[model samples]
Target: MPDMPALHALTRSIDSLAPDIVTLSDRIWDFAELKFQEFRSADLLIGALRRNGFTVRQDIAGMKTAFIGEFGEGKPVIAFLGEYDALAGMSQEPDVDYPAEQTPGASGHGCGHNLLGCGSLLAAIALARHLAEHELPGTVRYYGCPGEEGGSGKTFMVRAGAFADVDAALTWHPAPFNGVRSTNNLAVLEYYYRFKGTAAHAANAAHLGRSALDAVELMNVGVNFLREHMPQDCRVHYAITDAGGRAANVVQARAEVLYLVRAPEMSQALALAERVNQVAQGAAMMTGTEVEIVFDTAATNLLPNLALETAIHANLVSLGPVPFDEADLDFARRIQATFTREAIRSSLRLYQIDGDVFSNEKIDGTIPLHLGLRDFEGRSHFRAGSTDVGDVSRVTPTAQCWAPTWAIGTNPHTWQVVAQGRSPGAHKAMIHAAKALATTGLDLITSPDLLSEVRAEWFEKIRQEPYVCPIPDHIQPDVGWG
Candidate 1:
């Protein structure tokens, strides 16, 4: 554990510097950048680190938007991961319900990644400041990880050994609850399936034409039927990206479908994906078409690290939750009105929160670290989404925490959440999260025994299965329309 004085001073420093951090977050939110295109966001973070006396390396992993900032020296090389990407069609004005945008139909930070980057950066800066002041013996690095939304930016970074030498890593996401993530997240694989057939005029040579669209439909039907037999937790989703020729007068010659397979573990996800591929093959055979599959992105399931969870939970408790003001409470109430009572009630119940609404006030106390796999209604658990973070957990000791920054039932990638991302309430949550992360980093640096125990537990939990990338090396990130 970190000394009490050091923890207190760290928290105070974070709180005192809250405005600067909030400004950074707000600027990123205003920029509303997207994956692989976070040029300004990356520059902002990298520039901040440089100004703070940290040496920075840009264009990491052949990605212009990816970079690393480092400070200090010695045993534990702790890296703080940060993201700054927005979602398309989520542009909105701060605190507005309707689609009010400075640039209409533009991308926005609906995922709250603007805050994610700023909070992580602030945490890193705070830790760097502490180490310099106290002469701490450890190295701290900040990774400006881009394209987390769908670009698999970290996959490239991890492949390049960006995180190989780190003793430990820490990350956090803005959410509706504050707790250390100790449960396993689902593994996911994404790919595109293309079918090729011969095109012919429908009326004159329909019999001779093999419709690629037919193959796509058959594949979807096969997978839908397969769902009933697969494990209940397994998930399969797909969308038609191309339907060949648009004119009904001709038989379609080509079609494409994007498929995403997810399961509780990576092995299962891969197995399910293979089964899906078989379905595609069967479809191709039945339709007299040839099929080709191209993998886009694959991510592993989160390997829970109880050791890191415990350390992070301790810091979460020590820093407590974000202190809310009366105005903040009023804002929360207004947002709560947009949701049905039943929905709000269910969300609160899932997280074990009693109130119908959450105020700006700090949480009552520290929440116990949760180890069991659990689901939250209207939040992360109720909705299953894949993230590249899952891959990092499989490779090294990693843990993530979440802090509530929006209305009770606000979902990511929605306009409502995007609106809140630019609000003062969200800013406060970001600051609180930064303090917790910084405090946890300090504990890791000051306590060598804890880090060793964490590493040991991580090893025991994983049992030495080497990490395999879900996205094959041949696949490149496609920035084209999904």
Candidate 2:
């Protein structure tokens, strides 16, 4: 168990701050800002941090929405990573099972980032209070990271050396279950392949035309062929950003496609990227067109630290489970009715849970939420999805936990998640996560040997395979990229 005084202090602080925290999260959910354009959302978090006695710094790392709030002064600086950006075209009415958009085309918190950011802020505030009351020599910082959806906001922050001085970092995601993410996710690279060629009318100058659309088609075909020979773990996906024009009669003069490549390791991702580039070059040569490979953004694979995860897991065990009431369970069952049984099984598989246990509704009609904590036996789970958090883990000893903020089978970036964004259950889960993270923060701050063990694990891993920011220095966080 953690220190009694520190635990009580954190719990007390969270209780006092619970109402305001819930209000802030709901307001951010309303704002639903997207990517670097989260002006109102950033202002809201910044104002909250300042009001709570945290010294705030804005516009760091060349991104307007990116900022940090710090409290206390001294040796062990613990950071809580928070994100408030929402996904586009996901706007939905809260507490509704069916898809009803709040606005026709506006954004929504499909990934529960509103709960994510506010929960982290709550943890930071509670930890700061604990340090101040105990006269502890430590610093707590809340990182207001924007653009997590498709925009690698933390990756850019890492390149600017934002987290270089922090001893440890903690974060949490709003999910359907409570568990620590001890895993190595994929490293991803995104690029735009724009092709240029001479435009000519279809009937008048058939011989003079070099269709860029043809080049795009050829390149996609080439990439499809390359997929068979590449490593099974690597992935290559593309979308036709531009097909030149809607006029089928005209020979297209320009075309563009966005490609996202992912792999288990950065070296493998880079190598696969080169092979894809070669394929693009070959297509351009065959079509008599020039191709431009514009670098979009990238993030390195995760470097998991078992020591940091163990501390957070201990706190989760101590906290037992989120105090979800009957009303929460009723809402969850309603939301679960919208999705299929297979979706619940898929979600269980993602978390490495046995599908046969709770997936069948006949077996347990009351399995609305997986309220118990999962055991983290010092092993890394293999997560295929990528996140900018991977970049932060490469630099500092980073850890994150998932809280049950939605229904049991609800996946992220979907209408179902948006529907439950502002529910009472979501708010309770947010507070539950705050307690876990704050207690873990207290552990690192009060215990020197524990912090040293965490850092030792981090340093040893990076020493063998050094962390190189996958996003090049030349690429700035361009707000208009998306």
Candidate 3:
């Protein structure tokens, strides 16, 4: 393990604040606000940072929920990126194995971001306390990043120069396994295609009414056909946000659909987005309807730092496994029962774990809880999903870990995740992640050699291909709640 002065003090500080941190996480879970609207959730974290004696700033990048909290002065600044947003229509009763919503048609922490935000907060608090006690020269910052669910909150923050001065960044996610997130994820671009035409009676004026709904359908078809010609790694997904009208007797006057294009690189994603736009234009010409393309948001592809990942992996190995008791194990088993065999297999594949290791010798048996850390590979891998964190990575050296909070094979953005949001196992996972992050922060603050190595790697990568913010300058963050 890398040596640092008084590492125990940082871990002990986190342990002392365990109860309060868990309470904060549970409160956020209860609030369950959606993207760009996490007012109550942001307030709670901001209040905690202020009480800890850190200077706080709000409304970053013109975003109401985005903020930053800082402590200490000067170079070798380390930042902890925090997220506290929930998914739409995922409300569920806590501790329930089945799908039982606490509030119908409301938001819920289906991705366990309640734990994610609080864990990062606790890490920042512990690091700040250690720095103040030791009179350290470096600064510790907590970035209250909201709207990670399709909003690209961090991307806007990066464009606004939020992470320009930081030397290195650390973050962790609540996952089903404990390991370093040593992977390269895709970059993405999102847009809304709206078509307008004249509304008329379906039977009496079918020829006069150029149906906007037809244009929307044709656009989707053209994009589908274009898919076969694009790169295999690229992906395109869409959801019809507005389908003209419910009545079939009337020719629809307006229709809209949202498109998300993703690729291994930002340039590829941007080029593919233009192709998608051309398809939309073709559809508009075919149907004689006026089309409007509105930009939503965008995120860059992640650049992994092996030096930072190795340091974080050392801390995780030192922290050992999460202390899961019988009650926690029992709850995890019940949650695993709710998952299908295919889901379990898919999750196992994602984590690079064999199925036999998760099950006993019996034909039908329960999947055990993953209390121990997986073997660290210390290699760069690929993940199909995209994150706004990728934007931060482009600006500076960034590393993140995956701490096991849910049962094995419990996928995110599901009722299973919401059900276990407030469980004892999840709280333990949160604290474990905090300790790991804090210890890594200590190493970075004390060891200039390690920080230099991390930066050297980041510099070389960005030197080859300079980063350009995918979101254009003319577009502003969509502040509407809908």
Top-down TM-score ranking: 3, 2, 1
- The worst-scoring run of ten residues by lDDT in candidate 2 lies at 354-363
**Per-residue lDDT for 356-446 in model 1, tens only?**
2342222211221111222222222323567888777767788777777876655677777887887777778788788878988888888
Worst 10 residues of 3 by lDDT: 356-365
Each model's TM-score? 0.90, 0.96, 0.97
lDDT scores in order = 0.79, 0.89, 0.90
lDDT tens digits by residue: candidate 3, 1-482: 75534666778899998899899999999999999999999999999999999999999998999999999999889999999999999999999789998999999999999999999999999999988888888999999999999999999999999998999999999988887858888999999999998898999888889889999999999999999999999999999999999999888899999999999999999999999999999999999899999999999999999999999989888777888899888888888887776777667668864324445411122544676677767788788889999999999999999888988788889999999999999999999999989999989999899999999999999999899998888878887963
lDDT of 3: 0.90
> For candidate 2, what's the RMSD?
1.7
Residue clash pairs of candidate 2:
none
Better structure of 1 and 3 per TM-score? 3
| Model 2 global lDDT (CA atoms, 0 to 1) | 0.89
Q: List the residue pairs that clash in candidate 3.
A: none
